[model samples]
Target: MAKSNERRTNIFPLALVTLTGLFLVNLLGFIDTQTGSAFGCGRDWPLCNGKIIPEVWNTHVAIEFIHRLVVLADLLLLLFLIAATYRRYRGRKDIRILMGISFLAFSGEGVLGAISVLTDNPPSVLALHMGMSLIAFTSLYLWTATLRQIETGKYQRFDLQDASSVKQLRKWTWGTLIYSFLVVYFGAYVTFTGAGGYFQGWPFPTESYSQAKTALLIDLTHRLMALILFVLILRLFLFTFRLRGKREDLRAVSLQTLILVVFQMLSGALLIITKLNLIAFLLHVSIATFMVGSLGLLGLKASSLQEKERMKEYNL
Candidate 1:
């Protein structure tokens, strides 16, 4: 009975639910954008068309309204997660820092979203919105992954990793994470500017790019960056996989990151083949979101392992 009670102390379930809820909210936000429902609420903040329930409703209004509702619910869940995590793991400074970043990112998402809606949805604002949503989702993901590791008593295995491997992995993981964020921002910009639809072919533009030269440039830049990101993730995965026997956690995250990047690239091609189908576009964005989260997770694990190595070296 005492052992069971002790096991129940971890908040893994709550953290998982909160993370899932936030991911759903981010997806819904993208759906709202793809459907041209940003102004469905008519420049209103927290109120749909000047009413709490939106008296008049259409498909656009419904999508935007539903997105707002989901965001509100996710906000509540994030607050609960923060409070619960603090109460249970207040001694862990790293977890507290993760929670703080999660809270700030969530708040930035809301603020940026509101500003975007009220300002007629500028392209830059919308792009920033995309990045902020990913930030919020990724931070929550790291928090949840950390809690699970602690609950399973697997975090101690970081000490098993050699200092050299930990140092190399840490550098690569952090570099990939930063580069991934840049790729996300560039992709988001392409989407917001409608540059993705300007292409006549996938992987290569078969038609003349004279008409939409600006879009062509934007889309081309994004594609180049995404390709580079894919290579980076692939390299990270291979290096981490080689050390799987020592750091399984890092290997797992790197593998997931590689898979998600592969799917994201495929979805981008599908999006072009389907003439930018809404579903394909959403899938592309969703995969990118998950890939970013996995990269963040890999970076977090690498950092933890490096810290463990340092502690061992210091004989503390």
Candidate 2:
């Protein structure tokens, strides 16, 4: 019993470390992509330039190699977390579900990365790689945040007493998350497709080369979707802010989401104005990733709290 208690006590910090590692790996992977270094290791998987370590060091090789190393370390951390969670919280279906997702996403990300290296990383594959990394990162994040909430006893206040309201908020938050993810994905797709270069203006394409009409159209659609996402996030924030007295957690998450969306818009404009500058591009995608993850956290909490209300109503 004492050992189990000790393990539970340590879980939150361990999860936090693992989550941070995953986030760093995702950022490094994007850096690798943005730097056009995917082929740096010369179509090698689990090896750098046909060796465990590269015989030659160049900027591209260094970036890709470092990304792979970070991925390896993060995967080890995730595996340890999985084992710990199984031993300590095996009966927790939510924790188990999150672990399952984190495992699958990380695995998929690795496989995709390998395939991308082998295939020269076509635009679609590269985009999917980013998407998988985000999924893995978000799952671990959710797991860690859940542990923190439980440890701090903050989850107890999730009982809003009104199950219907919880359900409504959960649905709305989730729906918005889905839309935000689509927008993010399309933005990535636009980037990888090389369509972002055809646009000459922010919020609208001022001029288009004759051969780049499709690129222009795609970029325009991406901008429109972003506008709609901003409105959705704004509405979500207003609604949650009104309920601040009841669920400060949700209100805070909504505020964060709103702030991220605003920054995302600004970053988008920067990307356009700078003609897809690497820093601006990273900021745009990174903010969108966290924004979607924040909404996911909000929805998951409400969903869990709503379940508690259900059990209470049924006298379980």
Task: Please provide TM-scores, in order, for all candidate models, with all chains considered together.
Answer: 0.92, 0.92
Minimum summed lDDT over a 10-residue window in model 1 is located at: 1-10
Writing each residue's lDDT as its tens digit, candidate 1 over 136-174 gives: 899899889878866664434345438688778789888
Q: Model 2 over residues 1-316: C-alpha lDDT tens digits? A: 1112434768889899998888888888888888999889998788888999999999999999999998899889888989988887676677788899999999999999999999967888888888888888788888898777555544343444666776787788889887877887788789998998777677777876575778877887898999999998898888887777788877888888898889889888898889888888778778877888887888877776435533443344
**TM-score, candidate number 2:** 0.92
Report, for all candidates in order, the number of backbone clashes. Answer: 0, 0
Clashing pairs in 1: none
Q: Candidate 1 — which residues are off by over 4 angstroms?
A: 1-10, 156-161, 305-316
- The C-alpha stretches of model 2 lying farther than 4 A from their native spots are 1-7, 156-161, 209-211, 305-316
Clashing pairs in 2: none
